[model samples]
Target: MYKTQDIAVVILNWNGIELLKQFLPKVLEHSGDAHIYVADNASTDDSVNFVSKNFSTVKIIQNSQNGGYAEGYNDALQVVDEPLLCLLNSDIEVTENWLFAIIEAFNSEENTAIIQPKILDFKNKTTFEYAGAAGGFIDKYGYPYCRGRIFDTIEEDKGQYNDIIDIFWASGACFFIKNNVFNQLKGFDASYFAHMEEIDLCWRAFNANYKTKYVGFSTVYHVGGATLSNTSAKKTYLNFRNSLFTLVKNTDSKVFIRTVFRMILDGIAALRFLIQLKPKYFLAILKAHASFYKNLATIISARKEFPKRGNYAETDSIVWSYFIKKRTKF
Candidate 1:
C-alpha cells in the first residue's frame, strides 16, 4: 500500500463552507493514510476559517484569487510535494477504504497515471452520477460519454461496470493522477477555467502514452454542480466551448475534417435548443463557436507541443448512436 504521506487528497474550494462542513469530516475520518488539504480559492465566506478552526490537521493553501478549477488546482498543487495527487471536489463524500483501492490500482498497474473511482450521485445513491459514471469514453466526433451515462440517460449501479478497466478520461469530480505526470503536462489548461478540463488533461495523458483507468471497487458520492448548476447558461457555454478546445488541441489525424464535422453537429444542437424554446442554449453554442474561432491560432499552435495520439474514441458518432440509432445505454 502507498504511504498516506505520498498521497495528498487536495480539495479545491470556493465559498463552499457548507459543503466542507458536511463532507470534510468523512474525508478526514475515512482517508486513513492520505494527507488532506483544503485549497481555498479566495472565498469571501467563512469556509477557509471554518476549516482552519475545526480541521486543524488538514493543511490549508490560500490562493490570492478564485481561479476556478483548472488554475486553482494548478496553483495549489505547486506547493504540494506528494507523489500521488487526488484532485477531489468539495461536494464529494468518500466511503471506507476508497484511498486504499486507488492506491492499490496505482501500485498494481505499470503505466496507469490517472484513475477515477465509480461516481454515484449524492442526491440518489442508487444511480450513477452525471460527472463520470462508471468511466468516460469519447466518440469519434469528440463527444464524451461515460460507460453508465449517455446523453441524459444515467444508469443504476447494478454492478455491471464493476471491473477495473482502461478509460478515455477520468472525472474531475474525483480525479487521481501521478504528480510527475501532472507536472510534465504543466497541469490543466488554465484557459479552460472550469468544466471538461479533466477530460482535456486525461486526453493529453493519453497522447503521452500514459493510461487512465476506472476503479469500480471504490466509490464516491458527488453532489453534482455545487459550484455551477447543470442548467446554468454559463455551464452550457463552458461545456460546449471547452469540449471544442479539447478536440482541437488533442485529436490525432484529420484535425480540420473532424473539427468541421463537430461544428455541424454543434449547429444541430443549437437548433435543437431553439426548438426546445431555450434560445439561451442556442446562443451559447454560437458563442462557443465564436470563441473557438477567435482562439483558432492559439488552439492550432497547441498541436505542436504534443504528438498526435491514437484515435481513442470507442464509437464513431455518439450523436447518431444516441439520437438516430436510439442506443442510449452505454
Candidate 2:
C-alpha cells in the first residue's frame, strides 16, 4: 500500500513568488509526510531566493530554461523518486488532508494510473474552477469540458461531484500520476508547450489500458489562468493547436475524418468569434490551423509510436450538446 510519504507534491513555478509565499505554507502544513518540491522553470525573478530563504523544508529543482509547463515538469521530475507524483500549480491553495484520498485511491485502485482532485475557484470559493471543475471529459472531436463546466458556463459547487469516479482526463492544475506510467509515456509532448497537454497524456494512458480517475474527497482551489490569462490570444492558439495535435496522435481510428469534422466545427467557432468582434481570437484559430498543417507530417509520424484504442470520448459532440441542446451541466 502507498503511504503519504510516498507521494511528492511538486509545484511547477515560473516566477510566482507571491503565490508561493501565500500558498506554500498551507501545503506544507496540510500535507502529512509527503515530500514537497518547487520545480522552478528558470525564472528571472527572485522566486528561488524567496523559497530558499523562507521555505527551507521545500526542495527546489531548477531547470536550465523556461520550457513552459510540459518540458519543465518533464525535466524537474527526472530526479523525483517518489512513487506517486502530484504535478501541482503554484497558484493553487490545497485543502487540508488533500493527499489522503489520493493516496488511498492509489492503494486501492491498482489499475488506476492517474488521478485529479476536485478543483474550485480561489476567487469565488464556491464556484468550480474553469480548468478542471470536477473531472475532465472530451467529445469525439477532442473538445474538453468538465462535469461542472461546459464551454463558458460554470456551475457552483454544492457537493454534487464529491465522489470518486473514472474520468477521461485530469486537470493539469493539480494532476497526479504514477511515476512509472509517466516515464513509460515519455511525459507530456513537449510540442504542446502548455494547454491541453494533460489531456494528451491521459489519452495516451487510456490507449495503454490504464485508468485515470478523480478523487473528489481531495480538493484544491486554483486561481485559474494565473500563468496565462484566458483572454490571451497565445493561450487560444496553444489550446486549439495542441488539441488538434492530441486528436491526430491518439484518437483511435478515422483520424482524417475526425480531424476534418473538428476543423469544420473550429471554423464555425472562429466565425462566432468574428461575430463577437474578437478578431484576435479568430486570427488565433487561423494561425492554429496553419501551424497544424505545417506540423501534420511530424504529428502523423508520432501516431505510429503509440497503439491507438477505441471509445476514447464521452460524447459525440460537446459543442452540439452545449450550444444546441443547452445541456450545460455535465
Candidate 3:
C-alpha cells in the first residue's frame, strides 16, 4: 500500500510566479506528507529566488532551460525518487485531503498506472474545467473530449461525475502516475513540447496494458489557459499538430486511413475558422499539417516500438456525435 509520503507533488513552472504564489499554499496544506517540488523551467524572472526565500519547505529543481511541459517534467523527474508522482500544474488550487482518495485507489489497484482528480474551473467553481473535466477520452478520429466537456460546450457539475472510473487519459493539470510505469513508458514525447503529450503518454500506457483512472472524490480548481490562452493561434497550432502526432504514434488499426480522415476533419475546422474571420487560426491549422508531414517518418518509427491494442477509443467520431447529433454532454 502506498502512503501519503510516498507521493511527490511536482509543479512545473515557467516564469509563472504569480500562479505559484496563488496556489502553492493550498497544495502544501492539503497534500499531507507528500513532498512538494517546484520544477523551474529556467525562469528569467524572480520565480526561483522568490520560492527559495518564501517557501522554505518546498524543494526546487532548476532545469537547464525551458523545455515546455513534456521535456521540463522529464528533466525534473529524473531526480524525484518517490514511488508516485503528482504532476500538478502551477495554476491549480488543490483541495483539502486531495491526496487521500488517489492514494487509496493506487493501493487497491495494482494495474492502475495513472490517475487524475476532479478538475473544476477556478473562475466559476461550479463548472468543469476544460483541461480534464471528469477524465479524458478520445474519439476514433483522435479528438479528445471529457465527460463534462465536449468541444466548446462545458457542463455544470451536479455530482453526476462524482465516481471513480477508468479513463483513457489524465490531464497534465493534475496528473498522477506510478514512477515505475512512467519510466517504463519513457515519459512524455518531448517532440510535442506541450499540448496532447499527456494523452500520448496515457495512450502508450494503454498499449502496455496499464490502467489510467479518474478519482472524482479528490478535487482541484484549475485556472485554465493561464500560460497559454485559448484565443492564441499558437495554442491552436500545437493542439492540431500534437494531436496528429499522438494519433499516428498510438492509434490501434487502419493508421493511414484514420490519419487521413482526421486531417480531413481538421481541414473542415480550418475552413470554419476562415468563415469566422479568424485567418490566424486557419493558418495555424495549415502550419500544423505541414509540421505533421515533416515529422511523419519519425512518428511511424516510434509507432513500431510499441504494441498496438484494440478498443482504444470511446467513440468512432466525437465530431459526429457533438456536431451532427448535438450530443454535447459526455
Q: Which candidate number has the best lDDT? A: 3
lDDT by residue (tens digit), candidate 1, 24-78: 9999999987889999999999988899899889999999999999999999999
Residue 295 error, candidate 1, Å: 0.9
Model 2: pairs clashing at backbone N, Cα or C within 3 Å:
none
**Better by lDDT, candidate 2 or 1:** 2
lDDT of 3 by residue, 1-330 (tens): 899999999999999999988999898888878999999999999999999999899999999999999999999999999999999999999998999999999998899999999999999999999999999999898899999999999999999999999999999999999999999999999999999999999999999999999999999999999889989999999999999999999988788899999999999999999999999999999999999999999999999989999799899899999889989898
Q: Which RMSD does model 3 reach against the true structure?
A: 0.6
Instruction: State candidate 2's TM-score.
Output: 0.99
Per-model TM-score on C-alpha atoms: 0.99, 0.99, 0.99
- Order of quality (TM-score): 3, 2, 1
Candidate lDDT scores, in order, read 0.93, 0.94, 0.95
Residues 127-242, model 2: lDDT tens digits: 99999999999989999999899989999999999999999999999999999999999999998899999999999999999999999999999998889999999999999999
Off by more than 4 A, model 2:
none
Cα miss at 130, model 2 (Å)? 0.5
